[model samples]
Structure formats: structure tokens, C-alpha cells
Target: MADTAGDSCQNLREESARAVDNAKQLQDSAAAFISRSGTEEQSLRQRALAAESTIRKLRSSLDASVRRGTVDVGVAEKIEEELCKAGSIITDGDVASFLPSIDHGTFLKMFLGPINVRATRKDVQLKVKEEYNRYRDNTSFLFLIFPSALLLLRSWLWNGCFPVLAVQLYQAWLLFLYTSLALRENILRVNGSDIRPWWIYHHYCAMLMALVSLTWEIKGEPNCAHKQKGVQLFLAWAMMQGVAMLLQNRYQRQRLYTRIALGKAKRMDVVWGETAGVEGQLWLLYPILFILQGFEAYIGLSLLKTALVGVVSEWQVIVCGILLVVMAAGNFINTVETLMSKSRFKAKMKRSKSKQELDQGLPPCNSRLK
Candidate 1:
């Protein structure tokens, strides 16, 4: 019995020893696995950081190349020369005498002279001139009629003769005028002309409409709901048309200006180093204009909404806000392009002037000669 008991104890001790050894082996394996995983993770992080650094260096190099190589240095020099010449010409004459000549007709004659049909055989130039003339004529007509129509509307409304109809008609007329002006401006831009007058007219019309609307709202009784709804619809339609006009104007103007500048440079036997900058400037202006249009749209929409629903919704406000942001971003890009082009152009001009001075065996002037 004693021997049998001793044998059982020995078997149990052997079994326990085997179990402890297996546990130790498993623990060692687990430790090894953890150490290897940590090392691999650290290596991946290092590699990622190295890759990012290389990308940054590459991006910087690319930016530098674009700024120095892609930019038109020659064009910038030419613009500088032209500006100098213009400044001297203007300064030589009596300032007071030249002030009156700053009118649209005179300004156009001088500035457009370089790229006139006589200088270049470009179809675009002719188209631009035609468009500009049309805009001028239309604007003149609007100016002549708007005031008289407003007076008539005012009198009719005061007399309470179909007051709602009179108000609606007046609003319709204003809408038509603004819409026409916006469209003409866009067309002029497409033809490569700056429609500054149209821009001014649109703003003026908007202001006038707002005032008139406010006045009518205050003075007249809320009797003609149907006519008021019609007026609201007209305003909305006009606003939509205006936005479309602005978009078309922005894109067409950019193309037209770019082409006109190029044509001018080619005709004058001059390279504009600042073409990129000018383009960038236009890009910047575009976004700003877009934002402005968005704001205008928002205002018009808000007015219409209030008139219709008697309340403005959060969603509408959010939509307007988003549009404004997008417009601003577009403008920022445009501005950057213009500034860069201008800088490059100026640099090219300086280099050309320096070369000229050296060739002539003359000292470089510190200031540009007026």
C-alpha cells in the first residue's frame, strides 16, 4: 500500500512540472510577439514622416518653378513701359484740362486705340466695339425713361387709381430695366469690353427698386393681394435673370480681357510679362463679383420670401451663406492670380530697362522718368 501511494505522488509531481513548463513557453512567445509588433509600428511611423517631408520639398520646388518659369516676364516689362509712357503724357498736360477727357468716350478712345480695328484684324475687337456701342445706347435710353416712368407711377399710385396695378407695373418696368442692363453688360464683357456703366446701372436700379418697394408697402393698403403676388413673382424672375447675367459676364469678361490683352501685346510688338497677374486679378474680381451677386440674390429672395410666407426660414439663410462663401473663395483665387502676374510683369520690365541702360552706356535711373 505504501509503495502504491508513493508512485501516485510521483506521477502527480511530474504532471504539475510539465504544466508549468508549457505556461512559461507561452508567456515567452507572447512577449516576443509584442516586441516585434512594437518595432514594426515604429518603423511604419518613421517611413510615413519621411514620405511627408519629401512631398513638402517637392511641392516647394514646383511652386518656385511656376512662379519663376511659367510666368510671362516679358509682358510685365511691356505694361510697365506703357504705364510710364501714359503717366508722362498725362502729366505733361494741364490736369484740369485732362479731367473732362476722363469721360467714357475719351477714355475708351485712348485705351482702346492700341487694340483698335486699325491695329489688328481680330474679329473679337470688332465684336467688342459693337457690343460696347449697343450697351451705351441702351443705357442712355434707360436713363432717359426711368425717371419719367417713376414719376408717373408715383402719381398714379397716390391718386389710388388701380394702386396695386400701378405698383406692379412699376416694379415690372424696373425689373425689365435691371434685367436688360445686366444682360447687355454680360454681352459687352463677352466682346472683351468692361461694362462698368452696366455695373453702376444695376446697383442703382436695385437701390431704386428697394426704395420704391418700401415706399409702396408703407403708403398703400394691403388690398390687392393678387397684384402683390404677381409683383413678387416678377421680382424673383428678375433676380434670377440678373444672377445668370452676372455669371455669364464673369466668364465671358475673363476670356475677352485675356484675349484683348494678348492682342494688344501682339500688335504693339510687346510682350506683357504681367499677363498672368492680370488674369489672376480678374479671377480674384470674379469671385468678389460672384459673392456680390449672391448677396443680391439673397436680398431679393429674402424680400420675396417675406412677402410670400411672412417668415424667412433657416434653410434659406444657410443656402445664401454657403453661396456667399463660395463666391468669396472664387474671388480670392482671382486676386492671387492677378497679383502674381503683376509681380512677374514688373520684374521683367526692370530687367529690360536695366539691359537697355547697360547697352546705351547710361546710368540706371532710380525713378521712372515721367
Candidate 2:
């Protein structure tokens, strides 16, 4: 009996000791976390102060230069170069000049509700960018796979008409998708990402399309096939977009990595709206993209025609159709501009190569024929 009692007391003592040790450890961890957070906050404040100081100094210098009636070209060039470091796709000047109204903050507040989503450090920024790209890739895959499922339901399972609830759910998803995309793009921009304006605007149009689609009446009572035309066309367009997103993610990613390796692209460079093309991919990519744009236009025009011809006159249909047509036109114009720039770049490279070869072919000035 004595031994048993003694054993129980020892066990209790040991457990008490362990509990005390764990409590001490927890207290230490709390202190360390508090210290670490304080340090981080201090660091961030210092950085902000430093940036403000530098900006003030620059402003003073610029003011002085302006008072003298001539700013030094070297100083101006240096400022531009420093600003350009934000991105190859967008000059800081361009971003500053483009939309002075409301700006990124308004959109951020509108979509994400005043959250601080921008990462400050370089490593954090890169990680944010990587995750953003992955988000895009995953969504592209989803769109690709999801639409096929919908197509199957429409054609085989549902007998050529999508369920009303299913259509509503799909439209809701589209709204969420576009809202997420736009929010992320805005955050990325704040983090010094150089995405193009058109890409951001494209998401805006997509969001509008999705919003209007929610109100669109999906029916088969009156005209049967005619009533379902817009939804059918929209599903088809979604499929095309999915395919384009997949190809762009694949080819553009590979090209971006190669360019980074060659030091031809900035580390921060990303594929926004498919400006430059990889070798041998121009033929494969551009044609498909162009075809997709044309098809988008066709869908838009069809919807508009249906409304005009009294096939199905809904305000939702008209609004969605206009948005689609505008988006398609914007995409086509941007693509053509990209192609033209690519052509110019290629021509310049060829001319430079020819010049180099001609120079090499000539005999050295000091070389005498023996």
C-alpha cells in the first residue's frame, strides 16, 4: 500500500513539473512573438520614412530645376529608369498618367474592402506573384474542365437545355471568378507588378457580363431554341477562353522563363495580354487567339441580332452583347498591336545580324595578301 501511494505521488509531481515547463515555454513564445512583431513594425516605419524623405528631396531638386528653366536630361533619365524598374509592361509614368481619378485604392476598396494585400519585400512579392500565376493556371484549368461538364449536361444529360438553377450557379461562379481576378490584379499592381491596363479592364468587362447574365432569362417556353441562343453562345465562348488561357499559361510561361535566363526580361516581367511571342509559337498562338476573338465578336453580334430581330428582346441580352463585342474588339486591337511590335522587333534583329555578317566578311584593314 505504501509503495503504491508513493508511486502515485511521484507521477503527480512529474506531471506538475511538465505543466509548469509548458507554461514557461508558452510565455517565452509570447514574448518572442511580441518582440518580433515590434521589430517588423519598426522596420516598415523606417522604410516608409526613408521613402518619404527621398521623395521630398527629389521634389525639391525638381522644383529647383524647374525654376532654372531647364532640368538636366541625365537626372530626368535616371528618374525614368528607376521608375521603369517596376515593370517592362508598364512604365510607372504611364500608370501615373493613365488614371488619376479614384485610382487603385478605389478599386481595392470596391472589390476587397480596404485590405492591405500588397506584399512589401522582394521575396514576398515574388511569392505573391508565383501564387497569383498559380491561381490563374488553376482557374484556367477549372474553366476548361467545367465548361466541358456543362456542355455534356446540356447536350446529353439535360437534352440541349441547361437547368435554370445550374445556369444561375454558373453565372454566380463567373462573377466570383472575375471579382477575384480583378482584386488580385489590383493587389499585384500595388506590389509593383507590371500588368497591362487592358487585361485589368478585360476583367471589368467580364465581371459586368457575369452580373448581367444573372438577370438574363433562360427559357424554352416561347421560342425554345431561340430563347436559349445567348446562353449556348456564352458557354461556347467560355470554352474558347479556357483553351486560350491554357495555351497562354503554357507557352507564355516557358518563354518568360527563357527570357529571364537570357537577361532579356526583367525578373519582374510577366505575360500580360500576350505582347511578345516565343520563337515558332507565333504561328500557333496568334492564329488561335485571333480566331477566338472573331468568334467572340460573332457571339456578341448574334445576341445583338436576336434582340434586333425580335427573337428575344431582353435588356440583359443587349447589355451582355455590347460588353462582349467591346471586349472582343479591344482584344483584337491589342493583339494586332502586339503582332506589329513583334514584327518590328524581328526586322530590327535581322537587319542588325545582316550588318554584323557584312562587317565580318570584309578583310581586316592591316591584313596584307601574302
Candidate 3:
């Protein structure tokens, strides 16, 4: 009986030792797997970057060959499509999970200056844009109030007295606002956000005007009266512009979301202008934008008229007026161009759908009625 009990205890001890050995093996295997995963992650990013460089070079060469008539146009186009697919894979895949997907292009670098504004992750890049949009909305409302209040003080409380201090402070704020907007837009361009170039240029013009406004001399009482008209016109225009901006950001963003859900817009794309693709909102947004543009041009012409009639001949007024007119024209052109492009896109889509239906032996819905 004693021998039997000893043998059973020995067997138990052996089983316990074997269990511990198996656990140790599993721990070692887990450690190896974790190390290998880390190495592969790093390797993946490096390979993707290399691939991107090679692909760019290949594309450049192909473009040059096409331009020189060395490659068949059809073949070149098909190759370009394949290259684009490969590029998209790298951009949208885990390769960029912890790395920057794009550099600030030369265009943005010129505006943003020499610095790396690259974000580490996709979410961070998107958050920067979201913050900029919010900033624009808040500041636009504030700007609207500032000019409105200033004009009221000058007309009622101050009895047409030029509020030099108040006006100059407003100019300073304008400078700061434009500068911040330019910086944010440049950063957005760097982070693969597609911002319209003219919009950024408009801010540049605004910044210049703000600086000029700061330097303008506002003479006391009687001398201020003639120049006051120009200043007042500018103020009114600014107020209208602020309102337009608020409406633009609100409706454009809403339109952007709707299109994204409908698969009409890319996830990375944001609204570029006041003109939205949605019909229900366009009825409300475009008229206001057109009116604002007209008002801007009118103010500019008025300033020019003042200068011509010798009411106010300051270089500042002339420059500001020209800038304003130029901005109005550019905004008008951009809006029209956007509308035309959208129209063409819709027409193309309709044609494609009709062709597909015919190929499938299905008559068009309109044809069914006929």
C-alpha cells in the first residue's frame, strides 16, 4: 500500500512539470509572434513609400513619353489607370496607418512657408479640417456683428463721427483672421485636403486689404466725411460677406455630408464653394451668394468712383477697391465653373446609365411611358 501511494505521487509530479513546460513554450511563441509583427509593420510602411516613389517616377516617364508620341495613347491611358489603382491602394491601406500619406506640395509650401505640417494619422488630418470649419463659422458671425455694431455707433451714438479707434481695431482683427485662415488652408492642402486655390487667394487679398485699412488716415470731423462713405461701404460689404460665409459653411457642409452618404462625393473631399449639388438647399444658397458678389462689386466700383471724383484719393482706397472687384469676379467665375462641371457630370452619368439599361435589354423608364 505504501509503494502504491508513492508511485501515484510521482505520477502527479511529472504531470505538473509537463504542464509548466508547455506554458513556457507558449509564452516564447507569443513573444516571437509580437516581435515579428512589429518588424512587418515597419517594413510595410517602408515598402509602400518606396513603391510610391517608383510609381511617381514611372508616371512622369509615361507622361513624357505620351507627350513625345513615343507610347500609344490608348495603352498609356490604360497603364495610367493601373498606376492610379496601385497608388490608391498605398494611400488608403494600412501602409499609412502611422505615417504621412502626402507631403505639402510646392503650391502649398509657397503659402505655408518652410515647415512640415504633416499629420501622423488620418483621423488627425480630418480633425484639423473640422476645427478649421468651426473656426470659420465662429469668426464669421463675430465679424458680422463687429461691422454692424461699428456702423451703428458711427451713425447714431457718435453722430457720424468716424470711430478711428474702433475701425483700426477691426482692421487688426481682420488681419489676424485672414492670417489664421490662410495658415489653416495651407495645412489642409498639405494633408491631402482638396481646397480651392482661389479661396485661399481671396484670403490673401483680404489680408492685404486689412493691412492697407490699418494704414489709412482718418482725418477729424469735416475731412473725415468724404472718406467716411468709402469706409462705410466697405463695412457694409464686410457684414454681407460674413453672412454669406456663415450660410456657405452651414449649407455646404450639410450638402457635403448628404453627397458622401449617396456615394456622390469622396470621403476625403469637402465642399469647395457656396453652390451645393442638392437642389433643395441650392434654391436658398446661390441667390444669397450672387447678391453678396454683386454687393462686393458695387462697393468696389463706388470706391473707384470716389477716387475718380476726388472725394477720396488715397492709394489705399484704390487698391482695396481693385482687390474687391477682382475677388468678386473670381468668385463669380469659380461658382459658374463649378456649376458647369456638375452639370456635365450629371449628363455623363445619365448617358452611362441609359447605355447600361439598353445593354441589359431594359427600356428606359421614360421610354416605358412613351
Candidate 4:
């Protein structure tokens, strides 16, 4: 019995040593892999920056010529259009080809869903960009349509002229849309998008609210009193959001286009539409945004009160109310940041243009020259 015990002890010691050796090997391998990944990321980003710098130099030359009155405004814009093509080529060939697949891209494919079949890392990133563009376009359209329809036909809707079944179906549609958009945004973040984390959290919150609201009983007398009023309020919220969406869609696209033109952003596969004309429009947009934000806050507070007072004591309502307030705050903050940044950029550009003209033996303005 002693001899048998000794042999068993020796075997266990050998197994333990082997396991430790294997673990050490794995640790070394993981460290080496991570080092290689960092090196590759650094190299690729440097190359992209070099290419971007070259593009910016060319754009600046054209801009300078425009400021000096040597190039026609229309001609400079055309040149910019051509330069956008060059930017596209570089993005596709140089940058995209070199990028590594991020962890979330693989996770996205494994779990929720992928909108496209992406065989390579570049393919995944491109697909993410494409899907995001499509999602934004869809939302812009839906926000306008649903809100306008609800508002224009509110009286009829209140009287149950719109079938409960139809309303439910529309809500389902919205739920699907919001959920898909959130997933796509996650995938985009994985693909190197600079989307704020707060926005992503906001989407998650919205999806949860949508899901909970779907379970809301919109018909029948048992719980119809408060429930129906909630639905009506929701419609009004949607209408307010619709106006905000339209403004954001139009203004933000133009801002993005301007950024791309200035070489601050990678060019997208879309036309640079008519100029934003934002200089004279801030008075209109800001007030509208402020009103919308206030309204959203009021609705969220009301919902919270109802839930807290046990007027409609579903846990989902409580959670959704909290989420609504959070989302509204996030939205407002993001909007303000964007507006401030754009305003600063425009001011700087104006100052630079004026300086350039002065340097070129021209006055800052006709009145100044006179």
C-alpha cells in the first residue's frame, strides 16, 4: 500500500508541472499576439495620417486660391468634388485594407445579427458604415411620416378612428427599427466609428422602453383611462421628435459634408447637397431644439410621477421613465457639443479668410477698402 501511494503521488506531481508549463506557454503566446496587434495598428494609422495630410494640403491650396479671388467659387467646389473621389479611393484601398477586425465585430456576427455577409475586416467596416447610413435615412423618413400622420389626424385617432391593431403594428415596426439601429451602431463602434458611448446607451434604453411599451394594453376599458392618455402623449412626443429629426438630418448631413470637404472626416458615398445655410438659421433651430428638449423633460417627469404615485405602477413604466430622462439629457448635451464645435469652426474659418485677403493686398471688406 505504501508503494502504490508513492507512485500515485509522483503521477499527480508530473501532471501539475505539465499544466503549469502549458499555462506559461499560453501566456507568452498571448503577450506576443497583443504586441503584434499594437504594432500593426500603429503602422496602419500612421499611413492613413500621411495620406490624409496630403489630401488636406491639396484642399488648402484650392481654398487659398478661392480666398485670393484667383479661383471661381463654382470651380473650387467642383475641384472639391473631384478631391472627394480621391479621398474615397484612399479610404477603400489604403485604410480599409489595413485595418484589423475588432473584437465587437466578431461578437456582433456571432450574436444579435449582421446586416451583411462580411468575409474580411474591411468588408465588416464598410458594411457597418453602409448600414448606419441606411438606418439614419430610414429613421428620418419614418420620424416625419408617423408624427405627421398622427398629428394631422389626431382628432380621428383619439376617437379610435385608427384601429388598435394598426397602432400596435406601427409600434412593433418602431420597436424593430430602434432595436436594429442600436445593434448597427454597436457594430459601427467596433469598426472605428467615433460615436459617443452615451448615445449607444441611449439607444439601448430606447429599445427597452419600446419593448415595454409594446406590452402596454392600448385598448379595452379595464386600464384604458391612464393607458390611453399615455398613448396620446406618446403621439405628441413623436410629433415633436419628428420636427427635431428633420432638422438634425438636414443640418448634420451638411455639417458632415463640410467636414469631409475640409479633410477633417473621411468622405462618405453621398452627394454634398446645397450648402447648409446655417449661419442665418441658428435662431430658428435653437429655439425649436430648446422647446423640444423642455417638452421631453416634462413628459419624462410626468411619467415618473405617475409611476411613483402608483397611478400606473408597472415596473417597466418606472424604468422607462428613468430612461426617458437620461436619453433626453444625453441628446441635448450631444446637440450642444456639436453646435458649439461647428460654431467655433465657422468663426475660425471666417477669421482665416479675412486674414488671407488682407495679406493678399485686399481689404477685409468692400466697405473697409473704401
Candidate 5:
């Protein structure tokens, strides 16, 4: 009976040990599950934070757009899509495991959304055309008249040799004639006006002027100080003019690209209708001209200083110096104004994009996000 009791007690102890082992296995499984769940929760929280930040950035962008007075519906939709996707990644179980595929181009498109939308508008096209026309007319007039007046004034003031004055006058006249011709070509291109022989005449004359200027620079004899200075000025002017023409061509090409990209018109249509060449010419011309003016200013200042220290008259030096200063100031102002306008336009575009995003229920992004 005692032996039976001892065996029964030993069996009871074995059963208790088995129970403890089963409990430990259950506890281990629970601990592992809890650890995995905690990690997933942490990951989801991180995703939520990221999504919230993106949404906020999008919202800010939208607000900027409203101030710019332009609407971009497509951009708004895109922002909304991004927001939804991001939100899903944060809240949805399976989706949370995957990262959103974002890229620089995608972000850039979003940032420039307003510009893309506005560029597609018919009214915007019309406005751009009108502005181009106005610019062309003003530029043509200035190019035709200003150089002629400057030459005439120089001739009158300098009392320089007849040959020098004659050469300068002839060059000025040729420049004016070519500019008029270029303007006509440009107008024809824009209005679908008939092309005329005058267009060819202007192109030929411009090429002739360029060749003549180059030849004169190489072959002309400078017998006097005045003659030497005049030749130097003329050479500088000619070189700058040629550079301007090249730049103008590039500008026109860029403009054509811009128009096509904006879907305002076809490249062929614009090319056929407008003398994009003139636009290119101006683009090349202005910066070079500005630089030339700056150089001229420095030259004038140097001349003035030399005159003061030497036998030359102070009055003549002062007058030339003043003219150079005036030209430099004018060029500087024009350059600055142009830069400012471009900057303002870019800012407006940014604001417009932001506004569109905001309208679509997205938060604006920080300006620094881009």
C-alpha cells in the first residue's frame, strides 16, 4: 500500500512539471506576438507622421496658389491623389508595408502645377501673343532710332573728321534699315502677313554690315587719337551686335519651345507665322549690349582720368564720361528690372500651384521642400 502511494506521488510530481512546461511555451508565444505587434504599431506611427507632414506641405502650397490668381485643376487632383495614397499607407494594413514611389520630377510637376495649367489656357496664349507683339514693336522702334540719334549726336559733338562721321552715319543707317526689315518679318510671322523681298533685303544688309564692320576693324587706319577712339568704339559696338543676334536666335528658339510645351501653338505654326529669328537676335543683343555699355563706362572713366592728368581738355572728358555713365545706368536698370520680373513670375507660379493643392484638400508644402 505504501509503495503504491509513493508511485502515485511521483506521477503527480511529473504531471505538475509538464503543466509548467506548457505554461512557459504559451507565455513565450504571447511575448513574441506582443513584440511584433509593438514594432508594427511603431512603424505605422512613423508613416502617419510622414503622411501628415506631406499633407501639411501640400496645403501650404495650395494657399500660395490662391494669391496668384490662377487655378490649376490637374495639379489639385494630383495632390489629392498623393495625399490619399500617403494616408492609405499609414492606415491600411497591407498597404502600410509598401513605400510610396515618389520622384523629383513628380514633386517638380506638383510645384510648378499652376504654370503648367495656366500655360494650357487659351486666354493665356492670347495674352502672351499680345505681349510679344508689344515688346517687338517697342524694341524695333528703340533699335531703329536710338543708335541713329547716338551717332548723330556723336558726330555733332566731336567735330571729328568727315570720313569718320560718314562711316559712322552709314553704319547707323544700315543698322536702322535692317532693324526695320527684321521687324516687318517678325510682324509677318505673327499676323500671317505676306512675306516680302524686304525681309531678304534686311537679312542681306545685316550680314553686309557685320562683314563691313569686321573689315573696317581689320583694315582701317587710325591717324589721330579721335580716329583711334572712334574705331575702337565702332568695333566694340559691332562685336556686341553680332553676339546679340546670336543670342536673339537662341531666345527665339527657347520661346518656340516654351510655346509648344505649353500647348499654345505648334512649332511650325509659330515658326512660319513669326520671325522667331528676331526674338533670338534680341536675346543675344541685350546682354552683350549691357556688358558693352559697362565696358564703355569704364573706358570713359579711364579716359577722363587720363585727360585730367594730361593735355586733354577737362570739358570734353567730362561730357564723354557723363554719357558713358548715363548709358551704364540705363543698362543696369533694364537688366535689374528684367531679372525682377522673371523672379516675380516664378514666385507667382509657385503660389498658384500651392493654391490649387489647397483647393483639392491638401496642405501646402514648405517653400523649402522643393
Candidate 6:
């Protein structure tokens, strides 16, 4: 009993020390930020002070959690996330503009009601998670719904019915999907999720394309001789996206499960479907992804060519085409980099296993005797 009590006390002390260290680091970061801002020095200093105030509140909450003899992992993670974001603002000149908004938001809550500030912060964090899950659920539903709906709609629209309305609906759907994706990506980033920046950038470009498509007129618009062709191409792209999402949702979940089993990922997100896997990627995921990227590029170039030939003179169409090409190039490069990294990692792991077997003076299992 006494040993257990001593160990618990030591753990508490360690946590307290960590909180202190985090506080000191935050102070240093804020000081550096204040020194760096030239004309906006005062405003920057005020924002830093606000961030420091938030850090202190977080430390207090941590202390309370520790004293209660039950640390909330969620709270701890939130604190860490907020600190990282604040630190980034302080150190990264490119993101310094965001500090003002952060400061304003943090201070506004504290000023409105100091006593409930912690509760308010916790509520906000919980809401972020809730909204993210909601977004994912909606995306999965739409991924299935949109392609099927478009496929059916295409039959009617291709014949003599309301082609303008059909085109408008399609564009609207794209806008919704891309906007939601961009918002979700931003939320994930803010929550300190380890999503690739390239993926977020991809969503940004996609959103741009969708926005441009919103203004695209089909029937009555001039230079729209290839409108029907464009519709067919977009429908094909939509169908491909649906299939790609289905495959990705399945294989990525399995990959996450494998990662968790191998002590790679900490845990799987509960929103995904049931998963079963042991090790190594499915290989199928990459081929599907490559195909989707290729399709996107092909459709984009086709649209660009149509625009160049005066079939569509709108700048929005031109810009959208360019963004699609950019996204395709970025996706390809990113995918290739990921594949190479995974291969290298697998090779390293195999070498380590072989070394262990050799150290044990046992022939590799694949060896044959003659």
C-alpha cells in the first residue's frame, strides 16, 4: 500500500514538472514572437499574452485533473494540441496572422465568464469532434448517393429534360462535397490530427474547382458546344469517385487496423466500418487511387481543351481545369512518395527480423536443405 502511494505521488510530481516545463516553453515562444513583429509589435505582444493566459488556464486544469487522481486523456490531448498551435503561430511567420483570431476567441470566452471558461473550452473541443464525425457520416452517405443519383439523372438530362437544372444540381453537389471536405480537413488540422498537408491542399483546390463550376452555365451560355460531353465526363468522374471512396474507406480501415495491431497507430477511429487485417498494405488501394488520379487529370485536360477552343470562354472553367491538373500532379507525387516510404520501412523491418534469426544461429525459414 505504501509503495503504491509513493508511486502515485511520484507520477503526480512528474506531471506537475511537465506542466511547468510547458509553461516556460510557452513563455519563451511568446517572447520571441513579440520581439519579431516589427510594426505590429504591440498587437503581437497582446496576442502572445492572451495565448499565455490560455496556457496558464490549461495548466490549472491539468493540475486539477492530476490532484483528482484521475487524468483525462482527452483534456491532456487538447492542452497539448492548443499549445502546439500556439507555438506554431509564435514561431512561424507565415501563420502569425491567425494569432489575432486565436487571441480574440480565447480572451472573449474568458472575459464573458471566467468561472466557466474551462467548461466552455471543453465544450468547444467536444463540439469539434462531434462536427467532424457528422461530416464523415455525411460524406460517406453522399459518396454513395451522388453517383447513383447522377447516373440516373444523366439518362433524363441527356434526353430532352431540364439539362440546365440537372447541370446546376450536379455543380451544387460538387460544391457541397468539396466545401465539406475542406472544412473537415481544417478541423482535423486544428485538432492536431496527423493528416497530410497535401490532402488538405487537395481539398482546397477541389473546393476552388467546385466554386468555379457553380458559375458555369450549360445550355444558354455561349461557347458551350461541348456541354453534353462535359456532363458525360463529369458523370464518369463522379462514378469513379464513388468507387474510389468505397475502396478507400474499406482498405484504409483495414490498414488502420493493421497499424493498430502492429503498435503503429494508437487507435482506430470508430466512425469507420469493421476492419480485419494483420500486416502489409492491400496493394489494391494504390491501384485504385492511381486510377482516380488519372481519371481526374484526363477529365480536367479535356475540359481545358474545350475551353481553349472557345467551347467555353469562362475564366472560371479555365481556373478550375488548372486546379484539377495541379491536384492530380500533387496527388501522384504524394502517392509515389508514400509508396516508396512504405517499401523502405517494410524492407528495414524484414532486415531486422532476418538479423534476429541469424543472431539466434537458426537458418532462415525459407532456406532448403539438399
Total clashing pairs for each candidate: 19, 0, 0, 0, 29, 1
Off by over 4 Å in 3: 1-46, 49-89, 92-113, 223-225, 262-268, 275-277, 362-370
Residues forming the 10-long window of minimal summed lDDT in candidate 5: 95-104
Clashing pairs in 4: none
TM-score, structure 5 vs. true: 0.34
Q: Model 5: how far is 238 from its true place, Å? A: 2.9
Residue 189 C-alpha lDDT in model 1: 36
Our tally of clashes for model 6 stands at: 1
Candidate 3 CA-lDDT value = 0.80
TM-score winner, 3 or 5: 3
On a 0 to 100 scale, what is the lDDT of residue 175 in model 4?
77
The better-scoring model by TM-score among 1 and 2 is 2
Q: Each candidate: RMSD to true structure?
A: 23.6, 7.2, 10.3, 13.0, 26.1, 18.9
User: Candidate 2: global Cα-lDDT?
Assistant: 0.77
Model 3 poorest ten-residue lDDT run: 92-101
Query: What alpha-carbon RMSD in Å does predicted model 6 have with respect to the real structure?
Result: 18.9
* Whole-structure CA lDDT of model 1: 0.46
**CA-lDDT, candidates in order:** 0.46, 0.77, 0.80, 0.68, 0.52, 0.62
Pairs with backbone N, CA or C atoms under 3 Å apart (clashes), candidate 6: 223-311
Ordered by lDDT, highest first, the candidates read 3, 2, 4, 6, 5, 1
For candidate 4, write residues 285-363 as lDDT tens digits. Answer: 7777767767777778778888787777777667767777887787788768767877798898898788667767854
In Å, residue 270's CA in model 1 sits off its true spot by 20
Residue 345: error of model 1 in Å?
3.6
Point to the candidate with the largest lDDT.
Answer: 3
- Which of the numbered candidates is closest to the native, going by highest TM-score? 3
lDDT value, residue 204 of candidate 5: 49
